[model samples]
Target: MELSPTERTRLRRLREQGRSDRAALFAVLGAGFVCHLGVVLDGAPMVVPTVYGFDDDFLYFHGSVASRSLAGGQTVCVTVTHVDGLVLARSVFEHGVNYRSAMVYGLPRALDGDDKLAGLRVLSEHAAPGQWDYARRPSRKELAATSIFALSLDEASVKIAEGPPGDGDGPDAALGLWAGVVPIESVRRPPEPDPALPGDITAPAHITALAT
Candidate 1:
């Protein structure tokens, strides 16, 4: 399935970076666990950083029941981005960052009961794979205190910028300046056990494997 472009989603500038394929959207979303959720609160724009997870159809996020940002039934824009590298060009104007980004727009629905629990599980597993089953599940009271929301993935857009600088053939190239891509990557370090945890308790295989 291809992404349907709405007026807000259509890329007017740098159209070459825009991606209409659904797989591109999934790739951008799957590469990152954090997302910025944009909404209108009290007629003012608000953007909140939060952890999110997604399956085939919906993106899920959770917050305290009292959190004004998570109050659903209204349209929201969720964005995930991954910076791949820095494009150092001969000229400052040509310098840019290589990145993959996805923006999802939809009206989020508040989840409840089994659906809510499933969403929480997806969220947990997305952040830490296999830990959802390894750790204690949320109790009924805890579940009641949390609010989970699901936003449809039907409306979304993806953009990816990569490769070297784009000014190799420009007049600036004759200026005798170096231009190349400085690669960037996110690395996972060894797990640090909680100070309060007993020394005898070691990090589980699932958690330790991430550092490798």
Candidate 2:
């Protein structure tokens, strides 16, 4: 259950954390929307940011067939992160972040036909749970124009940080500084529609539900 060296080094508190925890990894992946995918292109490493979806055993990404980042024949390193808050300690040196992040390393397989369609649907729904079903599905030509890739969830790791900073009760404790966590969260706002649409038109139930 050892985390890969590359992934493990990304965290500052490696000694204080364990990266092989599956529950921690899944939590990070479940809370994120965008993932940065790294692949080799022309012998150079290329990191592409895209929306992704993941299950227990696989990670899915979709794009146009013309996307070289996905269609390239190389392994990929994908990372998803959710920053929950900023922990401000009495001393700047002890300032830290409350976050959950996951990194997965694997080769991607281009899905064809039915699998491709299903993968796209999964990704879309993942980004917006009810939006996919409430919106129009892809047409035949649309499906043909798209490409979906799936990565096995074999090699991966998760790192997490929570609660207050380390300086809360350190030498800086008597510094008389106001220190605490500035909690951060992502919230979905109400959807705005085009002005040209009918004045009587209202938002879909799914769109209205986004306020939650």
Candidate 3:
């Protein structure tokens, strides 16, 4: 299904880079576990970096129960972005970055009971695929101290910018200067075991697999 753009999600600038495909939105969100959440707290605007997870219908994030930023039932904007490369052009004005990003806007709902636990599971697995089962589950006391928020995925905007610089045919091309893409990639390194762990215990297969 294609993303249905709402008034706030409509792309007004560089519309060519805007994507309406739901798959594009999913790809951007799946590539990164962190997101910037924008909200108002105590009548002031705040943006906080937090871990996020999403399914086909909703996006979930959590914070301490005392965190004012995580208080639900208010409008919020969550954004996830991945930078692919630098687009070097002959002219500085034409230079840009290749990237994929998604912005989700909605009034989040505070989750509780079974819904809260399920949201936490989705958050855990999204960051570390199999660790939700590999590690111990949250205790009742821990759950009581946490607050989870769920935002609908029905309102979102996705944009992807890629390929070479855009000044190849422009007057800048005659400048006789170098112009190309400098690629950037996020690579996972070998897992570092806890210093206090037992010598006989090794990194789990699922964790070690990330390095490959």
TM-score, per-candidate, Cα-based = 0.94, 0.85, 0.96
Top of the candidates by TM-score: 3
Show where candidate 3 strays beyond 4 Å: 65-72
Clashing residue pair totals per candidate (backbone < 3 A): 0, 0, 0
What TM-score does candidate 3 reach? Answer: 0.96
Kindly provide the TM-score of model 2 when superposed on the true structure, using C-alpha atoms: 0.85
Model 1: CA > 4 A from native: 65-72
**Candidate 2 backbone clash number:** 0
Misplaced by over 4 Å in model 2 are 1-15, 19-21, 63-66
Per-residue accuracy of model 3 over 67-162 as CA lDDT, tens digit each = 665563578898999999999999888899999999999988888999999999999999889999999998999988888888899999999999
Q: What is the C-alpha local distance difference test score of each model?
A: 0.88, 0.77, 0.89
* True-structure RMSD for candidate 2: 3.1
In angstroms, give how far residue 174 of model 2 lies from its true place: 2.0
| List of clashing residue pairs for candidate 2 | none
- lDDT for residue 152 in candidate 1, whole number 0-100: 91
**Pick by lDDT: which candidate is best?**
3
